[model samples]
Target: MLRIKGTIGDWPVDLTVEMDDADWARLAQNLPVNVAAPTAAAGATPVASAPVDQLWLAAQDLLRRSGGTEGPQLMSELEALAGSAGAAKGLLVRLRHSPKVKIEVREGVQVFNWVEE
Candidate 1:
């Protein structure tokens, strides 16, 4: 059994998932066991290695260079950079929440702008 409790925006979420041995086995089959998870020491910033971090930096650079971009166009560029829709969307979500990025709606279209510090 797996329990997930969190908030989506202002809404509360509590979820529970259950799986039998076969289900677990099937799920595990699709996951890579060789890759070790990244870890951070106490009081230190967590680090994500390669492609993930590189992709994130590139995503930020893309926004910075553009000054501001429409939401869908940014997603398309990120998808090309990350080489997968899932990875692209992950970067987009991170950008949306980042302190360095600002979101606004321009003429009914969502835009992402880099916030200079």
Candidate 2:
């Protein structure tokens, strides 16, 4: 038996899950979105454009480095990053420290590029 509680958007929810290995496997396969971990915290904030702009820059850089690859894992990671605070509006700006770049089965790879205008 495992209990989990979290919030998505304005909804605060709690869950009590009891399952065996087989059940867990089935659940994992059935609901892949339910089994994602959050990204690490980027303390303070760097001077950057809006969250959307920052995301674009970061994504472009990652894509360039990754050779414009596309896959699932990368997409998921992107979603997580975007969902983080100040991501869409371009406020929260910080680069990944470790791995520098990682591969996502769905997303392929990261591609971010900062621009000056």
TM-score to true structure, per model: 0.59, 0.29
The prediction achieving the highest TM-score against the true structure is 1
lDDT of 1: 0.72
Model 2 whole-model lDDT (C-alpha atoms) = 0.42
What TM-score would candidate 1 get against the native?
0.59
Candidate with best lDDT:
1
For residue 63, model 2's alpha carbon misses the true position, in angstroms, by 1.1
Ten-residue region with minimum lDDT total, candidate 2: 89-98
Q: Which stretches of candidate 1 lie over 4 Å from their true place?
A: 1-49
Full-model lDDT for every candidate:
0.72, 0.42
For every model shown, the clashing-pair count is 0, 34
